[model samples]
Target: MSDNLLSRFLRYVRIDTQSDETSKTFPSTPGQLVLLEMLKQELTELGAADVQMTRPGYVMASISANTRKARVPTVAFLAHVDTAPDCSGKNVKPIVHRKYDGRVVKFPDKPGLTLDPATSPELRTAIGKDIVTASGTTLLGSDDKSGVAVIMTLVERLLRETKRKHGLIRVCFTPDEEIGRGVDKLDLRMLGADVAYTLDGGPPGEICWETFSGDAAEVIVDGITTHTMEAKAKGMVNAAYLAGKLLAALPRERCAPETTDGRDGFIHPIHVEGRTERSVVKFLLRDFELNGLADKGKILRGLCRGLQASEPRARVRCKLRKQYRNMAYWLRKDMRPVELAREAFVAAGLKPYDHVIRGGTDGSRLTELGLPTPNLFCGEHNAHGPLEWVAVQDMESAVSACAQLAELWERKS
Candidate 1:
């Protein structure tokens, strides 16, 4: 089973499915559709029923219960297929460290690249375990692929074990999650699951039930263009200078990513493009509380207004768009799923730690769609980068935990 998990994970990561954030298409990349078809075929071969790969690349499958129980609530497991666009996902080559010696492991070909324990203290816990990593070139794509492997392995285990009783289990692989548009084309009505769990978190035995309310802010500054040789104080109000002023005017100590923590709001500038004639600044705003989110937007607008006043010759425009809300609102009302997950982890001989996610997940958006979904860990660390790695023991534990979760759900609902 361990070999199967690693083999499947390695196979899935070899396919380049990097999502395009700039694409107007549903799946974002055509490569994601290819993987979706592969998963659909594999599920069919594993004897899963109702296997369907939608046009926009949403793969759905179901496993019927072997028990005679009636009125059992259906459960679903979800994971995304596309990897982060932060790094290249092409031609990923994974290397396995067998029985690690609690020392820093370096790439054989790249002497300068090494997984330093001093930099990442978390390596101590994974000592004496098998770890899969990239070749210090491309990301390993374990963020959600590990979750995919967990669900697939659990389903295969259930099918092989004849006596294991479970209700209908639905599984889905979504696309474009890295760009925050994963569930935009999701058909929840057809999914028909009473509740679902997204196996997309990091670290083993970690569960996340809360996330930040997110939004994007764009500020455009238009100015008159004048030749640099003929530039004067009032003749040309440099839009780039105006953009810099606006960025500086934002709460320096308070609204920064490095200084913020739990429940703290932040305004992160993601993109900046400017010239003397025109400039545009793109930022992402995140807050755990609704009122705080509104206040952050107001602060951003106030900065733009102040910049307009300082540079009267330049025109300033601000646009704020709400993305997704905090999942805590739904999790608070229904704590049964959280309790069930905790019990499942204990049953699988692992310690469960519950925390609020620093970033958003597909579970955040699924909760608002009336699913009340929460995120479970798949043991991948340093995601979206070339240094990504996942322990073999942790992956096995995740598969066991997923199987136990299905049984726990059967007993409760």
Candidate 2:
């Protein structure tokens, strides 16, 4: 199982499936389609029934039930195929340390970069286990490729072992999770699962059902432009200068990603662009509570109003929109999905623990859409960066947990 998992992860990471937020296309990038198509072929070859890749780059398949249970619920396992656009995923050369001895690890491409186990306590736990990472020049693509491999391996295992009693299982590989548009065009009706789980979490035995409610905001500042020779404070209003002032006015010392942790929320300005005539500033507002998320939006709106009033000559406008919500809001009502995951982890010889993500996942939206989706760990760490890594043993454990989860669902029915 370790060998197969490692090979699948290595193959998936080598294909550059980084999503592009700037693109208007469905999958955001063509490379994502490449991987999605590949997954469709693999699932079909693995004897998975109803294997299909949607027009929007969603690969959906199913493993028929081998159990005699009459009322087993259809369970769906999900994972994203696209890597984050924040880091370079092109030509990702995954390096597998066959036997990880607790020591300071260095990268071949970057002489100055080093990963010390002492600093990263999670790496210490995998002292004698196999570790995988990328060269210093690129990200390891472990953010979700690890999840993809785990699901695929589970499918393979279930198919090979016909004697393992389990109900029907659905597999879905989504694209563009990094930019938070993973399920924008998802065919939920076609997916047809009573419950779902996303294999997109960190560490081993981690189950996340809570996530930050998310909103996206864009501030467009339109100003007058004139030649420097004729430029005057009263005659010309520089949008770029106003944009900088608005950014500076933000509560960076307190209400920002760099300063916030735990359940604390933040108003993060991610992108700023344009020139003296016009500027666009995009921000992401996040909080675990809906009221807190609304408060962050209110803060940004008040700031925008202030900027408009201060510079009457320039037109300032802010567009705030919903992205995803915390899954806890819905999961708390019926925690069967989360409870099943916990029992499955214990069955796999792992002590399960509850966790909350400072960020949101595809499961967040799926839960909101009435799927009751929870998140499961695939051993990814330091995601969306060049220092990303995963343990082979941990991935195998995740596969075991997934298999146990299927059996538990069948047994409960």
Candidate 3:
């Protein structure tokens, strides 16, 4: 199982599935479709039932219930197929260090790059386990690829265990999770599951029921452009300059990703584009609570209003788009899914504990949509960057946890 899991992860990461946020298409990338098709074939080969590539390129499949008891809930397992666009995910060279010895690991592709336990405290915990990482030039794509491998492995194991009693299981592979469109087109009725879990968290034994309530803001500053010779203080309004001023006015200390941690929410400026005539600045507002999230929005709108007041001739429009809300708001209403996960982790010989994600997941939206979905870990660390990695043993444990979770649901029902 370990060998198969490692092989699957290595093979999957080599494909460049980085989603494009600017693409108008449903998936935002062609490479994602390639992987989705491959998963569809793999699920069929693994003897999964009703395997098909659904609309918007999601791979959906199912396994029949082996339990004799009637009225067991249908549980779904999901993982995203797309990697983040934050760094290069192309031509990834995954290096496996068998039995790590608490030594500094260096990247051959980057002479100056090294993974040391001194700075990476997580590596210390993985000293005796097999670790997988990419060459310094590219991200490892373990953010959800590890999750994909874990679910695929789980499917393979459950199908082989013909005598194992469990409920009907649904497996889904989604796309564009990195860009936050993972479940936008998904039809819940077609999924046909009472509850779901996204294997998209970090470390081992992690059960994340809480996430930052997320929203995006686009500040467009449209200013009048004039020739340099004819430019005057009153006649010329530079949109680019005002955009910079908006950035400058953002809370530098309190509400930034770099300065905040734990339960601290942030207002992150992700993209800035355009020139003198028209400039657009994009921001991401995140908080664990709805009111905190709204406060962040107000801060950005106030800044835009200030910019508008400074130059009445220029138009400063702040547009806010609601993304996934914090899953805790819904999960707290009924924690059966979380509790069952905890029991399953214990069954897998893991000391399970609850965790809160600073970022959102597909489960966030699923829970908000009345599915009561929660997040489970697949050993990914340092996600969305060159230093990302996952331990093979951790992924194997995740597969075990999911399998145990299915049986627990069966027994409880």
| Model 1 lDDT per residue over 1-413, tens place | 99888888988999999999779988989889888899999999998899999876799999887767887778899999999998899989999999988888888646788898898788888999999898888899998899888888887888887576779999999999998998988899888898899988877889999999999999999988887787885497789989999888878698888888877889988789999899999998999998988989999999898888887889999999878889999889989889999999999998999878877999899998899899999987999998889898898999899888888787776
Clashing pairs in 2: none
Off by over 4 Å in 3: none
Candidate that beats the other on lDDT, 1 or 3, i.e. the better one: 3
lDDT of each: 0.89, 0.94, 0.94
Q: What is the lDDT of residue 180 in candidate 3?
A: 94
**Per-prediction CA RMSD (Å):** 1.6, 0.9, 1.0
Q: lDDT by residue for model 2 over 1-413, one digit each (tens)?
A: 88888999999999999999999998999999999888999899989999999887899999999888788999999999999988999999999997899888899999989888777888898899999999998999998999999999999999998887889999999999999999999988999999999999988889999999999999999999998888894488899999999999999988999998999999999999979999999999999999999999999999999999999999999999999999999999999999999999999999999999999999999999999999999999999888888999999999999999998999888
lDDT of 1: 0.89
Error of 2 at 110 (Å): 1.2
TM-scores, each model vs. reference = 0.96, 0.99, 0.99
- Weakest 10 consecutive residues of candidate 3 by summed lDDT: 225-234
Residue pairs with backbone atoms closer than 3 Å in model 3 (clashes): none
The parts of candidate 2 lying over 4 Å away from their true place are none
lDDT of 3 by residue, 32-118 (tens): 999999899988898999998987789999999998989999999999999999999889999999999989989999999988888
